[model samples]
Target: MVLPAVGDVDRMKRRIQSPDYRDWRKKVEDIYGCLHPVRLTGLWEIADKTSGEVLKSTSGHILAPCGNRRESVCPACSDRYAADAFHLLRAGLSGGSKGIPVEVADKPRLFVTLTAPSFGPVHNRRFTASGKQAPCRCGRYHHERDPLIGQPIDPDGYDYVRHVLWQAHSGKLWNRFTVALRRQLARAAGIPVREFADHARLSYAKVAEFQRRGVIHFHAVIRLDGPHGAVDATPSWGTTELLADAVRAAHAATHVTMKAFTIDGVPVRFTWGDQVDVRPIRAADAHQVEQADGTISDDRIASYVAKYATKGTGKSEAADRPIRSRAQIELLRTTEHHKQIMRTAWDLGAPVVCPDCHPDGPHRVDGCGCARIDHCATCDNGGYIPGPLDELNLRRWTHMLAFRGHFLSKSRAYSTTFKRLREDRQIWRFEQNLAELGVTADSVTVINHWDMTSVGHRSDEERELAAAIAERTRAARKHRYQTERTD
Candidate 1:
């Protein structure tokens, strides 16, 4: 590999030795360890918004956003995002952050998993009731890390069409399920569905995870709260058992009827798959004590959900990068099954000619012969209508296997929001910086005008140095935590 220039190295040393190096380093610390930092150049001023009196001003300087949420894209930013997710989930369960009342820990909380129905049989690791390894349907015992575990046994028989359609409408299905869950809860409590809102409320934070089979499943932390949300007490009828029952009933009953559209002259309807799993979340303090029936721990659930929040389909046989063209789709590094699904999406997204119009035939309008309109008799029903395939919007989400929904979502009452947490962090950092600078202010406003300058590392040597620094920082943090535990 080509080495870094000697002049560049000397300049870097001089910059590091500069009098303002410490301040500059602190300013860029947030993005210093990022694999790819979004560099920006701008002038900034801290002034009074009301009086327009400038308190502080800075000339043009380089800044980094460090806002990426994907670990594969930027490890530093993703680590921060995951930490925020952990706090958000843990606060909802333990109730020590974001102004959530501590009594929320006493509420009926559940760590539920809602899965996508199986489109077809795939290679899976099967276990007997006694926790013994069992042979898969294909007559072989698969390993825990088997690459073929999620691949279809019969690729040709796999339902790629419904799979993509289900992925596309997964968000809608979740919405319907939530509505049904509230109704189910009301019915179980012997109250009218309309009156359910007056008695209790449901709050949840969910993260979508892609199984090895390339299908998306939701892992959610669902909590039953009082009608006024975290502020009020839960009703007497709001028990963990009742919540579990409602979850099962809602998952079984919920379905979304896709808009009527023809796919090769046949109508298609979408619904959730048959597989659904729901489990109660124990108290955080008691999470370590496992139940006889293999119950999930609250801490484990929080960590699991948080971990997946920064992940993508790359863990499985799917592409993390967007597939914008036929060439990209064909060149995707995935299993044959995943490749086929991507191809189906691309094929569906391609524009098709109107079935009513024939290029070689004459128009029905008198002397109009308008070839543009498929139905010349009336412009109302003319031209090409989006078929079921086109309605899927496959091209926009081809990289996600046609899933267009966010990987992480939450109800309004589900603890604190990502935005709130980020804002709090920003305020804390600003305060710390002000203290370091020996500045005191009752109120201040920051005005910023930034333009994109550059992104990523300047050279492999710089990337290596940044990565080393990041690794060391992580190690130091880990060591400190261990030391605290030991102490």
Candidate 2:
């Protein structure tokens, strides 16, 4: 033990005295000392764009990219992403950021939730209209944090096939729903769908969340705008009531049929579950006076959606990363229901014999002398082809339980984009750096060539040190925020 301690002390001293130590420390500090830094080896050259004079040149060392958006992968990066998402969402609701007019806040806004259709009965928490906690039908009152809440009452009876398929096609379903919503708005306005865009526009920012039952649900901030989008005022005909009516009509009418596949000779269809909830988003001042009915506050809605934006599947579901092999699937930490759903995805995504190509016969060689010699005329490629269900690419999304949609999305006019926000931050930082360096150049161009050297911490000690620094930084930020709130 003494020898090891001495060795560590000597190593630390050597590291501290190294020429690259300061540069490494600065890079780490720039990233708030990410716990898992991605190492890179490259060069950066900054020069005057007009004069073609080199301002600075340096070799790139270890750098870290925003590791991931999932908190499970990197809490620091996810927190940053979540903060950006919050601002983006809040700007659309409260306005006053990213060029959106402050008056847009008072526009007709709604907090809408679109849920997956019920594939089968599952354990769930219930509450009465009076806010009384009600016991489930299983004759047992579950705790608030019950892990079994979303599990099927009868696991074997659950419709895992449709559940995974719905998850896989959820993105398409949402597209169809949006089109229907616009059509409904048009109908309510007594205009054609094509002409509706000329009269008014619909803008929304939506985030996908996994339900307790390991299915995808959507939470959105929907706003109606004028024909020119957020920059223009909404038409007088567009009202909160009208938007609400159109939302209901759209939900009731919207349905997406999968690309016509027969499973066990029965045609399978997909549609949103009957349970749909849409509520008006009241302003902050109105929140205090609004009855505690189902209505949600704008701030609360933005925060809620942002909270889900940083999350992967809920803690109760499969792992955040992709499930690559059978071994990984077998070792997954999810419940049996989720496992069955994953298995269904894999089974459906597996390649199968093309029915049309090999009808009434086993697969044969090309010696049959068919008219289409290059490829099979029926399947258009080969006798063994991807199954119809496989066309959805379910296998690639097994970790998401077959859901491949983006976690967060928005209409073009909803608000500023994440990319824009990040770019603005980078520009601000660069300008600040230039000021500190006392550089008085009119404009500077930077050319960088970087290649990944390695990823992750060099050792457990480095990882622990980075994590400690990150924790301290987070704690300091929290304290400052609290102080500001108190003030």
Candidate 3:
């Protein structure tokens, strides 16, 4: 697309007709003769930095991204993200990428699921070990494909207020849980809590997800490592069995006590629900084993976690405001179990001052009503609820309060640090860049100049040229594909 440019062209025209134009015109002609036509080419040059000597250079066809989004949206970049994630997880688990040893997998490995306690009963797919389906509490024999599986089993008894509060505080609760878990592990191993660090370290990657009920649960890949991380050897006593036991003990012992809420002159305290499942990660066996009822290996775990990475609190009426509009909120509110949560969130957002909780500082991040993220101590408006918001669909996650974290996030020492992996990627990119420039050896030195400019679509003439080139390229590809197919 050619931009309409009158000023520059007009200035040049005026200069052409000036009184001293004859001499000036001769100089302009000389310069214009030297100007190169914009014949497109992929080109590069490299030179010795100090001596200004040419060392190496190379270039070839460059394919710019189309910026599409249809899964089709830049398949190159999307595949890159998926591949990187695969390598990242594979590196932490089996230690393949980089120099991480396979021995790391032999350490105390656990694929665990930690759930939110019940605020109220939400509808769930219920079946016995023999696959006998049970009736839903809603007094209906729901079908196998019922969409209400994650909704409140009993809407009136559900506690949406508590659920949202838990979501808000989920991060803090996880931190506390980790601390308690370390203590439990040390106690199980007969080591002092302080000495536990000396024996082994806890490495984990966890991803949080919102259930159909609109509450978050955590799926974590937890491992035990030596003090130095995956590279070091864990103590002799550190076994998967011991780790499993410790996890159970930790879960059983863990509790968070909030100030009592007075309901009709009675005080109430809330804690984690009784449902906790701690399992041992058995030795790796590729063989497929069938249970009495057929359920294949959990293939969707990665996709499940990946799905939540793009979700927002607004999806469950978990955010103060919907990301879209009030109409969207209305849709979510009218959904089976999200209405009560939406109403409660709106009601909570109305009052400037918290009824029970006080401001440790200004109630929001800057002028935005959202809480300040980095400097958290500045706000005491933790969004604590006086009573659990009774809404079954919103009940299970009463602990979270209303925020969600990414699944499979980790601290620096947990497995390999993301920083280190990123460094590896950077090194790989640099190597590719050098290779592209035809640099022969690692010892070779090179320098390159890059002239950055924004180029808009050219005039009709240029567009026609580009279209012709594209047509030729497509025809060439079709010919090549036909040849391959025949061969």
Candidate 3 lDDT for residue 458: 27
What digit string (tens of lDDT, one per residue) describes model 1 on residues 1-487?
Answer: 9986664356556656879767655545656477677767787877765687876777665657467776656667777787888889888887877889888888898877788888889999999899999999999999989878989998888888888888888999999999999999999999999998899999999888888888888888899999988888999988999999999999889887654755676766666677777777776665452467655566666777888887752253667677878888677767877888888877777665445553444335544335555544422445444544666688878888888888888999878989999899888977885676556555667777888888876666556656766676667767986787521
**Model 2 lDDT vs. the true structure?**
0.79
* Candidate 2 lDDT over residue span 91-176, tens digit each: 88878788788777778888888999988888888899999989887767889789888988888788888898888888988898
Best by lDDT: 2
User: What TM-score would each prediction reach against the true structure?
Assistant: 0.85, 0.87, 0.61
RMSD versus native structure for model 3 = 13.4
The residue-level lDDT of candidate 3 at 132 comes to 88
Q: Assess each prediction's global lDDT (C-alpha) against the native.
A: 0.77, 0.79, 0.54
Best-to-worst ranking by lDDT:
2, 1, 3
User: Would you give me the overall lDDT of model 3?
Assistant: 0.54
TM-score of 2: 0.87
Candidate 3, residues 1-487, lDDT tens digits: the string is 9987765455444544768557433432322211112222355555655566666564542223222211222222333344344455556666654567777767787766677888887666677789887777666677756777777866777877677666655666677777888998888888999998898899877766667777667766678899888888988988888887877777677665444434456543444557765544444332332224321122233333333432322233343332333244455423547656655554544323443333453345456443333333333535443333333222233212245454447755555554576688667866786677666444455543333232322244333333344345446655985687521
Would you list the clashing residue pairs of candidate 1?
117-273
Q: Quantify how close model 2 is to the true structure by its C-alpha RMSD in Å.
A: 4.4
For candidate 3, the 10 contiguous residues with the lowest summed lDDT are 30-39
Predicted structure 1: lDDT: 0.77
